[model samples]
Target chain A: MHVKKLRKNTFFSLKGVMLAGIGSLALSAGANAGTVRVTVAEYSAKTGPYFEQVAKDFEAANPGIKIQFEVVPWDNLLQKLTTDISANANADLSIIGTRWLVDFVEQGIAEPLDSYLTPEVKGRFIETFLTPSVMNGKTYGLPIAASARAMYYNKDLFQKAGISEPPKTWAELEANAKKITALGNGVYGFGLQGKEVETDVYFYYGMWSFGGDIVKDGKSGLDSKAAIEAASLYKRLIDEGATQPGVTSYAREDVQNLFKQGKVGMMMTAPFLANQIRDEAPNLKYGVAPIPKGPSGDQGTYGVTDSVIMFQNSKNKAEAFKFLDFLFQPKQRIKFTVNEGFLPVTKAEAEDKYFAENADLKVFTSLLPIARFAPVIAGWEEVADVTTSALQRIYLGNGQIEPTLKDAASKANAILKK
Target chain B: MTAKRVVAPYVLILPSFVLAALIVIWPVNELAQIASHSVNRFGQLRDFVGMANFRALLDDPNFIASLWRTGIWTLGVVGGAIICSVPVALVLNEDFYGRDLARVIVMLPWAVSLTMTAIVWRWALSGESGMLNSALIEFGIIDSNIQWLAEASTAFPMQILIGILVTIPFTVTIILGGLSSIPDDLYEAAALEGAGRWEQFRHITLPLIAPFLNIALVLNTIYVFNSFPIIWAMTQGGPANSTDILVTYLYKVGFRLGKLGEASAVSLVMFGILLIFTLIYVRLTTARGARA
Candidate 1:
């Protein structure tokens, strides 16, 4: 009797579980009609609250249309999207690094927005910022965030080192760094970032100034004479103690921190650092300037953008597009740009006083014309990794510039072939 | 035996067997499938290519270097932890004032998340404005601050040291449990026989705790071999992939480089290596039991 009762109990419990699962599935199916899920990359602490408020306001404006958001960190966004897509359970919309859009489009995971992007809506975006997300004559994504790099210098350090202005050329920068080093009380000049994301971009500032392209005529320009000279110049800076010690240990953030503490004379970074300084080190007087030009007067800066893309598999495409339309409005763009310290992506946002009159943002906007985006190619991340590794080897004095770069070029070429 | 009796054990174990297959076997089989195929960045499978993914990994110099480093990382952490834990466990097992406090302090690190611990270490080991450097300078230990994460030489060793530190608490706990299981009369007998402290440890405590030591060794080797956060949070196996172990390399390949096929292949290799180690360990232990 006891055994029979136990069997009956197990049977009823299993049936109950199945019923509950089916009921939840039915509920989700019903909810899916009006719900649009968006996976947003968390840019800062304010990113979540800002987006949540937007979603609330959007839902209020359009009754019966709910906006659900899954906020992921910047570092884990790609991983999350990959897993989500592989399982065929991705959100209706997502924010991805502009560089990764090529992969998304190649896999047919991104929905082209050309049909929904009317001329009036399209005219709102800066052409330069919008160009990266447009591929094969179709807009697969919209520029949600954009930033360009510029040189930041410590005014106090410059004054103490007997310099009246920021250096205008690499040669002058080196001399100025030496001067700052001489005034050392644990101070360094030319905060060189040798690690982490965009390490290749850091080297590219010099490479471009020396008139080398990342990829010239379908081959890697890493082994070009220009690249070699750039590497050599950076190495000389390290050997002379003009940059921070153990440069391979200092990522972009680390160098920025040193600049914030007023220990570093100069560092080239994104405009976000200006915002960071305002909050974290308000007393540190700083100046923004163009990246130092090469001997021949060539100059370049790295422009980065993150895009919010519509997934091809989205069930609620109309609802998602509606939300996106609301999001790209000047009002929404201004709030996002100001809160995140991103440069203005829309025309109206650019004309706003917060951006138009800002001295630091002026430097960044001026450089956008010469700014270079990461090349749109399959396996670009792999190419960037190769470049970063080769640069690291050069930075650590582990490999010679010529051979190390040559080896890295061949490796990059092989990847580019694929 | 009756037919019902013969089938009862299998019937009783069927549910757990199905669950195990679902959780473990299913995913591994799927991974094997992905490993043998050409997978895109999003893990969509393409043409089947037998042994090609594995061959590609073997050809990559970075992959080979990471494999060997992973071996060193596992051996260093496991060996260091065992050697350090034995003395610590013995000391903690002794009757002393504040023994509970000492044990808690020793075990405190294990209570924190591994990633959190690693992040704290990253800040403390920073080249400039780091707590470690300031403390060293304050003590006049060196004329200048050392860049701990600058290269593989210093960075890798410090990573190993941290791995050992985190592994100690768990290891010492296991060994302490082993120590308590040993009857006090054995030590008493050894002492009566004019055995010194060393002899008591060697003849009585050591042999008795051999099983526990073996267990700790196996578990620690598995944990340390697959450890990701410490190295990742520190150097990210960077400065030219010098400090990279297989797991970090797998992450780079799978996520960073978007080579899912090669990444799956690398994981299978790791699985194979661990499987072999566990098999050999089980064989040795069973053979020793038979011999005794």
Candidate 2:
């Protein structure tokens, strides 16, 4: 008797669910609407409502399309996307780091948006912001957020150290750092990031300023004279006790935290540091300047961008493109750029008067022209890891910088060749 | 009826047999295939490279260095764990006040997540703003702070200590279980013979707990050999790969570098090494079992 009753209930529930699904489908057909799912990494909790509000507005205007929003934390975004793609369960549109564009293209996982991009939409993006998304003459994604590195110094500390201006060159920067270190407080002159998550970029900031490249003509560039000089400068700063004592264990976040606490005199970071300072340390006085020039007056910093990618396996491409269009509208893009404190990827947003009037963001915008991105290639992360280890060796070990960098370059070349 | 009896038993164990095949046998077979082929970043197998991936490791200096370092790491963690566990296990097994509480306290580190342990230790050992440095300075043990994880020499020792901290709880619990199984009457009878406490422990307790120690030794060796998070979280095998072990290196090569073929080769090599160790260990212990 119990088995019969259970079987009858299961049959009725199955029928009811099927009827409900069909009823919703028919009702959606009457409205001629479809759902497009989108995922974005939450820049901060404060910005969560911006995405939901935009999605609601898009659905209201489009009438025929519903939007599904997935907001994930930054740390979990990459893993979630990779797993989704592997399982063929990706959203129609998603935010992905520009670094992964090449990998996505090589793997045939990202949909090439060149054909989908209207000429008007294509012209809206800053050309440089689109560079990392291009592989083999085809663009696979659109830049949604951008960053350019700059040197932020504690103005109060500089004044106390009797410095009238920010350092203009590498030598001057080191001298300034030393002077600040002698201030006799628990303050460190420079906050160095020596741990994971772009420790190599710190080395590259100096390397690029010194006009050195990691790869030249598909081979290692560590043996170059410029590379040696860059490595030497960092080593000297660390050895002279101008930087924080535990550099080899500090990640970018740690350095940022130190800067926020007024424990650091200077840090080379993105403009987002301004937002952090505004939110966490409103009273701290600071100044932003382009990264110090090398002996020859060459200066550059890494330009990083995050892009919105359409997945290859997405079934609702048409609806996804519609939402993408809505999201990139000048009105929406400007609000996002202002809210997120990221550099504008779109020309309209870039030309907006709001960014120009914002003093903190203006400093970063001025440096954007001189920003240099790391080589977008397969196995680039491995090269970065090797560079990080090599930098650690130079800073911590008794090894000479030239040989150490040379060894690292060769190791990087081996991975690139493979 | 006789034929039905055998078939019915096989039917009963069929689900577990399939599970074992899927979980263990299938992955090992896949690993074998992956080790022989060159794979792209997207996990697509591209070419049949035969033993080229394995041959590449013969010339790769990083792999060689990591292999040697992994041996030292395993020995340090396992040896330290044994040294730490024996005393704690003995103390916990004794009749004392709050013995149950002490046992739980001894096992608390094991219950805590490895990542949490790593984070706590990393903060404690931080050079400029660490509790350890502050305490040492206050007591005049050192005049200045030491960058424990920034230098190769110190980071290596710190990595081993973190490993021991995480492994000791498991080791102590296992040894404690062994200690409890010893009949109290044996010690009491020895006491009646005028045997001292030390003599009773040496003759009765030691002999009975030897098997448990062997178990702890083998298990700790395997656990320490495969351990990844504590070292990865703390140092990421940094300070010029001075603290790198095989598993962390494999993760770097596989996930970061996207060299699945080579990573598979590294995994197979690690597996082979551990398998050999386990076989020899089991043979020696089982032989001792037969003798006993």
lDDT of each residue in A331-398, candidate 2, tens digit only: 99999887777888898987899876787777787887888776877778778878887887777755
Model 1 stretches with alpha carbons more than 4 Å out: A1-31, B1-16
For each candidate, give its TM-score against the true structure: 0.95, 0.88
Instruction: State fnat for each of the candidate structures.
Output: 0.73, 0.50
Query: DockQ (Cα-based) per candidate?
Result: 0.48, 0.28
Model 2 spans > 4 angstroms off = A1-39, A42-91, A330-339, A351-354, A413-418, B1-17
Best prediction by lDDT: 1
Q: Give DockQ: model 2.
A: 0.28
Candidate 1, A380: how far from true, in Å? 0.5
Among these predicted structures, which one has the highest TM-score? 1
- Root-mean-square deviation of Cα positions for candidate 1 versus the true structure, in angstroms: 7.9
Which ten-residue region of model 2 chain A has the weakest summed lDDT? A1-10
